[model samples]
Target: MKARAVARVLGKHVVMIVLMMFWLSVLVFCLSRMAPGDPLQSFYGDAVQSMSTGELEAARHRLGLDAPLWVQYEKWLSGVAQGDFGMSLKYKRPALEVAGPLIGNTLILGGAAYALVFALAIGMALICVRYEDSWIDRTLCAAGTVAFYTPAFWLGTMLVLVFSVNLHWLPGSGAYRPGMAGDVADRMRHLVLPLVVMVASHVWYYACMIRNRLLDEVRRDYVLLARSKGLGRRRVLMRHCLRNVLPGIVSLMAISVPHVLSGTYVAETVFNYPGIGLLSVSSAKYHDYNMLMLMVMLAGFLVIVSSILAQAVNEIIDSRMKGAERGGV
Candidate 1:
């Protein structure tokens, strides 16, 4: 029975993801087709300008761009179903092939920044909770608020100016120095500015949420009962309040994946990091439909999957959620 219930839940999530991806693909395909741009320019560059009408038509036919919009989408969708993402007009390569390494770079940069942001947020939240309404708490709150409101691009640019332009302390762009790709130190240097931007733009928001949640939890009747039973404030918070609030924290983290992912993209663009974020920008600018489609679909998949996983985790962490699911089922 348990196995059947789990299978039912998995089946539902799978259907939801498939439907979402179908709609997302249709939307992106239609929008990209309707957008004003000559995809030939992305493919042929300056030569596109020199091509005669016959030559242009031949080129379009060769690239399958001469087909009707719906037909083109059908063909593209068929190719996608077969694990073929088609060619990138801009890069003159398989869309996934061009994006594969960039995806890894994005994972590394975004993953590092994400982990660091949560770590700092959790630490700061604990500090604020301990300090309560003291000067330290007020100071952190003010700083976090300011950081939260700061635009990512502006923050990244400022960091670049201060650390890269003026002080010459860090490499301003790319994942690493060109020839120093194998050097972990060089890679870390390049990551510093982008990481700072990502962390600053996101950490405070989560920190404030956590701080508020912890404060509220500490005032609960159960927490008071724990304290009345001769528990120290620190012990009560760590053993009772913090533990009780963790499931919510996990839920919050999962819900924020999309938000945090957007911040990572912004950071990537500002830093000129060779990641899917930068590739997405260039693909859109040049009307690289295949590349754009892949990026959008990949991001959408991540968002949908993360939300599903979060729900599943919540059900596991809280028996009430499982009961509710069972009742609904």
Candidate 2:
């Protein structure tokens, strides 16, 4: 019975993700088609000015731009099914090959930022929860508010001014110093400002969510019972309330994936980091529909996968809690 229930949940999430991907592809395809400027023209650059109408028509046909929007999307989607997202119009190479390195760069930058955000958020939450209703809690809450409201770009710019320009402490931009790309220390130094900005951009939301959820759990009957049974405050929080709050923290972590991706857009651009976000900026400037559409699809895929994982975490935690209750009874 439990196996059947698990299968049903997995089946539902798979169907939902498939439908979401389909609609997301359709929406992004239509929007890219409607956007201004021809990618071929962007690709050809000054040469576009000299191309004859027939030449332009041939180029359009070769690039599938001459087809009806639906036909174009159909061709693209078919390619995607075969692990090809079409070729980059600008680079004249497979989109996957061109985007491969950028994806890895994004993973590194986003992964680091994600780790820092969770660490700071959980640490702040624990501190605030321990000192609930005190001045420390109020101070942390205010700081969270500030971080939540501050634009990532502005914060990154200010950090650049202070640390890179004024203090000469870190490289102003790029993934690494031009000649020092092979140096681990140099690469890390270059990453610090952007990583800090990305973490700051997201820490507040998670911290607040965690703190609020934990506080709510503290007021629950289970927590009260634990405390009344002679458990110390810390013990009650750790043994009772904290476990109950894990699912909420997991949910917040899953939901924050997109926000972190968006923050990467700002952080990468501000720091001139050569990641998916920086690629996205350039793709937009060139109206590279193939690259842009692939990015949109990737984002949708991440959100769907994260959501499913979050649900799984919730189920696991809830089952454990139920098992604990049964054992206690």
lDDT per residue as tens, model 1, 1-329: 99998899889999999999999999999999899989999999999988999999999999999999999999999999999999999999999999998898899898998899889998999899988999999999999999999888888999999999999999899998778778988889889999999999999999999999999998899888887888888888777788878888888888888888898889889999999999999999999999999999999999999988888778777897678789999
Best by lDDT: 1
Q: What TM-score does candidate 1 get on C-alpha atoms?
A: 0.94
lDDT against the true structure, each candidate: 0.91, 0.85
Error of 1 at 232 (Å): 2.3
Model 2, 188-262: lDDT tens per residue? 898899988887778988888888888887888877887788888888777667776777777778767888888
Stretches of candidate 1 off by over 4 Å are 317-329
Which ten contiguous residues of candidate 1 have the minimum total lDDT?
315-324
Candidate 2: lDDT over CA atoms?
0.85
